[model samples]
Target: MIISHKNILVSGKHQKSIVTDVFYTNEIVQKPVVIFCHGYKGFKDWGAWDLVANAFAKAGFFFVKFNFSYNGGTVEQPIDFSDLDAFGHNNYIKELDDVESVLDWITTTHTEYTDFIDTTKITLIGHSRGGGIVLIKAAEDARVQKLITWASVSDYKNRFPKGADFEKWENSGVYYVKNGRTKQEMPHYFQFYTSFIENKERLTISRAAKKIKIPHLIIHGSEDPTVSIEEAQKLHAWNRNSHMLIVKEADHVFGTKHPWSQQYLPNALQKIITESVSFAIF
Candidate 1:
């Protein structure tokens, strides 16, 4: 039977709490650890993630996923954007620190769950913006044994605004982007760009990819409109030893969307789960 633990709080960047979830069997058998990081504007319970966790747990792996401390979700509400102020203040560095905190909790602090987690065989999986975070973390942390990214961005600097738009943001201090689903205007403070500039070297995904010595798997959807397939190719090009998989006709979310009502994983997402589980085991 799959044992699911939800909404466990962990200390995160700037003392903010990170909402976490863990899934595994009740067997207490040592299993390889898989930590998942959600992307920008993402939460732990987004879409079909709960189903994803159950899938991993059933496959004989201890799966963990968490929300970034400042992803705009509060402890009471771990889904959707509840606090835009916190979201505006969020930066890549904070997200990285949050991942580290989760790592520490799973490996050393969470004694109750540690019995089922193989500390030395931990793998980090990230989606979209999170893909970059896990890549950089895997490069810096020795605990991570394998790395996987889904629809990840190759370059962060390019994603930022340029010229007039950037100047406008700098002058205004913050910019707003409409959340198509929620119809909410999300704010991105100029500090976000400044923080990236300050930590440019450490946040470089290309450099991290080159530094990772463990097995790295890059997965992307060919039809992904949010992040192009070439980004995954770039990651592959940087790490020649890395393997890449392109899901033909799959979109950014792998045929899944917010408020995913289906009980089972989508066909494209199931393919990813199979590939990822195989990668972690072998």
Candidate 2:
């Protein structure tokens, strides 16, 4: 297995955006491709991801995981919240564009896996918020053959606080949410809401899921606090063809943190990978 990390410059809202990718290459030609998108406040190099990528590569798949362009990480610093400005400016539409750009890169620019990856056989795997983005993308893009979401949110509108004065928020221009662990106040500009409202028709997960005619898998932890298992059920319910799997006792992040310590796989995460592998291959 040959694993390499590279920086990619992607076209974005204003200027070129930098994204990092972890590519797993094998000698075999025309292998199925698994493109992974990280969750909110997550990076490609987050805990256990390297091991997960290796696992997929070992399973005879060409795996690629990348950072969303505005995921708060820069080319110089690929981990942690070093660029809050970028994070603040991020929105769902931009993420969808980023994924499209990555797909374009995979189809046109990247040469290392040119012969190894079958662009038509691409599968997208998204974790948490990334899952919502993938669902939207898969519905619109015909290139995606399979879709998988782990602990994903069914609705993007639910992310914002309810019963708020829209006029005040529009006037204030920004709202802040406290990151309990980091103790940092993350700001959401009014543009975020405006963007969603403008793209509401295109961003609806249920709407997208209903249009998806390909294989779809929804996996979530029964004990997930961040995104309840019910949300997973909702996603499955939206798509008649989707398969839903709930881990017995796993919580959000599958019992892993930003700085995960254990060298071995957590039972819950291992189960997710195993199930996903089966879904992707079958």
Candidate 3:
């Protein structure tokens, strides 16, 4: 199997461009498409994601991964958090718009690859916050045929600061979140909360998951400290028809850390890719 890669930029909401990567092979005709959405502070080049994309491509599917327009990564620097201002202005609604914008590009501007892709069989795979965005998109968008989330959050409400931190945020107009791995100061503007209030129903992941008429897979880590396993159970309860898998020892990132330099995929991360690809094809 000859795996091919393409890096493209798609125009997104708020005049920003979403930097994306396309992985596929010319071996098959009309292969399925899987769009991967990175979570908070995550970019297309994070950790072993490139290897993960290659695994999916080798599994007979066209894989697409992209950095959200306001995900703090610029086209020139797609690996690090270089655009703090854009990150501060990001909101759930804008993320939804970003995913839709990518879909529009794949279905329209990227038609040149129609011979190698089956547009009707689009599947979305999101990790963490990206998972929530994909859940909402799957419910609202008719083009999404299947959905999958890894270490996903159950809700986006109340994720902002609280108490003294909340007070500081209200007074300062922006709150800073420290990225433990990069040690970079990330900003979350007050508009992030206002946008949630403005589009409460539209941004509700649980509500959107309940309305999904297609197959859905919920993958969570039992030892995940960032998002408890209970969140996955809650997602399964809301969407009982959806399948759920709890990897016993996996962490928030399934044992894959940033700056991962190994040529081989970590065991836990490989398992995640296997399950995701299996569910996607099933």
Residues 23-77, model 2: lDDT tens digits: 5665766778899999988888899887788778777788888788788788778
Q: Which regions of candidate 2 deviate over 4 angstroms?
A: 10-14, 164-168
**What are the per-residue Cα lDDT tens digits for candidate 3 across 1-282?**
656554588998779889999888767598899999999889889999999989998998989999999999888888888889999999988889999999998888887688888899999999999999999999988999999999999899858778999899989999998999888889999999988989998887789888988999999988999998988998999988999989989999999888989999977888888999988884
**Model 3 — which ten-residue stretch has the worst lDDT?**
1-10
Better of 1 and 3 by TM-score: 1
TM per prediction: 0.99, 0.94, 0.97
Candidate 3 Cα misplacement greater than 4 A, ranges: none
Candidate 2 structure lDDT = 0.84
Candidate 2, pairs of clashing residues: none
lDDT: worst 10-residue window of model 1: 111-120
**Clash count in backbone of candidate 3:** 0
Error of 2 at 271 (Å): 0.6
Reference-based lDDT, residue 84, model 1: 96
Model 2: worst 10 consecutive residues (lDDT sum): 7-16
